[model samples]
Target: MSQKQKILIAIAGPTAIGKTALAIEVARYFNTEIISADSRQFFKEMSIGTAKPNPQELAQAKHHFIDSHSIKDDFSVGNFEKQAIACLGKIFENHDVTVMVGGSGLYVNAVLYGFDELPKASDALRAQLNERLKTEGIELLQEELKNLDPDYYAEVDVYNPQRIIRALEVCLSTGKTFSSFRNKQHKERDFDIILIGLNTDRELLYSRINQRVDLMIKDGLVEEVRALQAYQHLNALKTVGYSEIFRHLNKEWTLSEAIEKLKQNTRNFAKRQITWFKKNEGIIWFEPTETQQIIDFIKEKLITTTK
Candidate 1:
């Protein structure tokens, strides 16, 4: 197949929606490899907490970007976009279709549409914002951002102070709306994209999330966090599972309380992921449990797209 014949299948949805299993099955069906779009799973230190594919699944299909880097290294979405593009290109050489799967909406978008390079924020401004975030609390900056850029405030992760501070820093440094830089015009790709989304009932999805969090704890998530505690300050480490436990280690909260927070935060993360993926018009949504329906849909898409 030439560039025009190449097909890219994007498996996206909320966490615990059975993306990993379905993606592997799809890859096996197409005799293709998998490219992960989950940002958290990219770090080598994060396994149980990130819900990496088990050994059996790994053996079932060739996977990329799993445990490929450390948190100590700075890996941005731009880097992910470039690397994923190259990997997709090479995989397409021998395979007609490649499967990219994860719930990380931003990372998914980065590969589908090359992200724009924003003007760098001044060091002085970033330092000031960082100090304010530490002293004044994230709520203060979140309130300010709500006032300054309501659009961004509406969509951003409010609990993540780093995101709030980074948005504000860019706004203050560039004298432009942080949301303005996000107005992207899609870049054409060499292949045709076929987006397959998986969804579940809200109640069921939340239950699955809580159960998964409990499973992570049982799988030594705490020990994993303990091993990486020295690098807690790194941006890559500032995520739901690790950050909540970091609070416990710092004595900010009790172990039990941190675990509760992790469960709640994971549920919230899933809700946000659904909301983000829902807004993307390109996604073809399906109930995850409907395996036969999904397979038939994909086969139909391939026939129509490749013809």
Candidate 2:
């Protein structure tokens, strides 16, 4: 008889979509563990802003990759893919299934389909791009990228200078659009993947995003950003909540304005996430409240796969 295939249930969706709760529930149902693919939550320094699992929720299930690295460390999607696969290997030793959850589509895809090997940017090129960012401003880089690779520009977080710079570096170095290198071929994985994407109405998701940002502020998000002020140059700190608050600290905007920008940026981020996940036809969509239905669907898939 063939051995039972170990399955990796990937819980994916936008910010404030309750992926963490659903992942924990699914892990508990399968008597398995969870691997978090949320790139923002991986750093130990980020907590309230990242919406990491609370003490009670974390204690309810075994979760790996949360607070697994220091923000000072140079972690990339490639690194995550390597580390997460190793994590899943250990997890699969004792269980037939493991749950992976996050809204970071690239990180999730890294585990599902390994990244294609691309040419590394030289230090000179990186320094040149950084210099250009310092002098020309982000707008120039954004416009250039849009002209060069409209496909990537459409989905990329335009607010993220690091991501924009990286894509530009690749485009400049290879004389090709950065999107051309993505998913050109797939890397095989040992386990089967089932993607469960949680979604709700657009207005409802926006409301949740706004409310979540408010909660983050009340929960001392400003203080958190203040603490990490020294590391603002780090790529990890360039994220949504921290970046907007950094602008406030820099006196570019009032605290109230910064908070508003935070909400707006978060909503924009969620929209991009939905766009990215929608491209993946394999994802089985459901509302966040339908936990039982998701579990049943998973079991049904497992039964069919086994048969």
User: How close is every model to the real structure, measured as TM-score?
Assistant: 0.95, 0.97
The ten-residue window of minimal lDDT in model 1 covers 153-162
Candidate 1 residue lDDT tens string, 165-240: 7789888887777888873687788888899999988999999988998899899988999988999878888888
Q: Which tens-of-lDDT digit does each residue in 1-307 have in candidate 2? A: 1223888899999999999999989998899999999998999999999999988999999989999999999998899999999999898888889999999888999999997787788899999999998899788999999999998887787777888999999999989999899998788887888889999999999999999999999999999999999999888998899999999999999999999999998999999899889999999999999999999999999888767
In model 1, state the lDDT of residue 54.
88
**Candidate 2 error regions (>4 Å):** 1-4
| TM-score, model 1 to reference | 0.95
Model 1, residue 46: distance off in Å is: 0.9
Position 273, candidate 2: lDDT: 91
List of clashing residue pairs for candidate 2: none
Error of 2 at 195 (Å): 0.9
Provide the RMSD of all predictions against the true structure, rounded to 1 decimal: 1.6, 1.3
